[model samples]
Target: MDFEEDLANDSEGALLEGTGKVASNLSDREEILQSLDSIHSQINQELNTIGQAIEHVDAEELPNDIEEFSVGLSDYGAELSQFIDEYRHNLSAQSEYFETLSSEEADFADITDGIENVNETHRAMNAHWYELEDTLISMQEILANFEMPTPQEEGE
Candidate 1:
């Protein structure tokens, strides 16, 4: 199945069966990890773009761009909040989705690495920026993936 795609299209409706309106964009445990990684990359890329733009920005141009990006980040943060809300909603179910990692392909490791990227990007953003956008990243969501490995290793 298109595992990664599964997360992106996760249903955003209220979880009548379990938790509150937490964003659980995943039907499987691996999807949780996958979604986290996907977000991690996106956030990192945005941060990098902001950082680079800031460096060469004219003194006069910097403030305006910063404000615009800050607003954009607000929108992004809201989106992530929704995603997490969905995530929590899914996890609220008593039937845990965790299983032997053997179900996942090696490509899934790329998702785990994406989690690390979240940590690194968070750190870099924190060091560089002075606004909430710099540190608004959720580190644990991505870090959680490390415990879930690829299918090959889990089979052993």
Candidate 2:
């Protein structure tokens, strides 16, 4: 059978029947713990299966996966961090504007400026969101195209 089927079968068999009811007393808690233990065992078994499968995978594919992950991370991580910092700064400035606007001495100019600042910050956030989304989509496409080479292919 395929990996997914094997995993599903193993996991399904590990479930404690009627586990949907909430645990109230000590006995129920013990049952829950037992269920958890069963699940953990299944997870460990599946992890071992996965490790064995990885061992059989083409060695070159591993480096490609790492490179893909690293490139995507490097491309987005710094820019996203910087953008978040700028957003935080803008939010802090907006908070100060709100504090000022709450005062009796605050004028209409302050209100307009505050609104403009908030709108600008929102626009920047939306723009950055789209860029991040595009980056994720591109990376997902790369992942979709990637495949573990079969033993036959690896042999060739």
Candidate 3:
């Protein structure tokens, strides 16, 4: 083969190799997308369950309940916020890794879609969390304002 023909064959070979890589990347992207979808669904389901539980709570007044109820909610909110912060940090790292991978592989371009799905899920999670926090704070405030009736006042 002449020099030009040899160079043309080498270029064609490189293109085929790159094509193989792209196909493999596409398969991997599909798997990642499936996993993200599953996670999204699971998060939504769990949040729904939590919402249902909160909705069904029966509030009743009891002796010496104010102090314990306020303290319990404060502690629970702090712990739950810490856990969610850690989870979101991990998710941010995962998104950055996927973004880098997508930039490197042409066939992995769809990875951004999966990442966006995760972002949407995260937003929904945060919304629910914040709503719960607000509700807890409001409950605490309401409890703080209550003055237990003295025996004389109760009798009247």
Candidate 4:
């Protein structure tokens, strides 16, 4: 019989049931870890692009009143870049730990520990992202308050 049928036919005590559950948990956890890694990479790439854009902004070209806003944007971008680096480091370490668990027969405790680690990292990343979002919103409001020069006045 197939593995699923074998598992279903097992009339043993709770041991078989527990084993099947652990196997399922491991599979699900692995998929989540993989997805997290992919997301981390994408975020890092986008942050890099933002950093580049910030660097390209010409402070001298901005109106005197808005020059400070540009500086604040640069500072925020730098802080975000640093945070992303730290998050990536945490993700890499967790990935390595998960890899080690996979190489051996992990017990329930080990699986649980790995899952907890992933959850904690996710929480930390989410918190940092929220902070960044708030900063961006503030910047957007500041920009919205600035008066744009009319195209007809630009040539004069």
Top candidate (TM-score): 4
TM-score of each: 0.31, 0.49, 0.36, 0.50
Per-residue CA lDDT of model 3 for 1-156, tens digit only, reads 332242244344322333333334444655654554464455455444334333443233223564455455555555555545555554555444443443435343455565576678668767766875686577658657654433333335
Which parts of model 1 are misplaced by more than 4 Å?
Answer: 1-33, 59-66, 78-82, 92-156
Q: Which ten residues in a row have the lowest lDDT in candidate 3?
A: 1-10
Measured on C-alpha atoms, candidate 2 has an lDDT of 0.52
Task: List the global CA lDDT of all models.
Answer: 0.44, 0.52, 0.49, 0.57
Model 4 Cα lDDT, one tens digit per residue, 1-156: 233442343344112443444344545655665664565465455445444434554445335655455457657756766665776677566545544454436566876787688789879878987987798677678667665343334435
Give every collision pair in model 4.
none
Error (Å) of candidate 2 at residue 117 is: 2.1
In candidate 1, where is summed lDDT lowest over 10 consecutive residues?
A: 94-103
Each prediction's RMSD over C-alphas, in Å, is 20.4, 19.4, 15.5, 9.1
User: Which pairs clash inside model 2?
Assistant: none
Could you arrange the candidates by TM-score from highest to lowest? Answer: 4, 2, 3, 1
Cα lDDT of candidate 3 equals 0.49
Q: Candidate 4 — what's its lDDT?
A: 0.57
Query: 80-121 in candidate 2: lDDT tens per residue?
Result: 556556655665565455446445576778768777877887
- Greater TM-score among 1 and 2 belongs to 2
TM-score of 2: 0.49
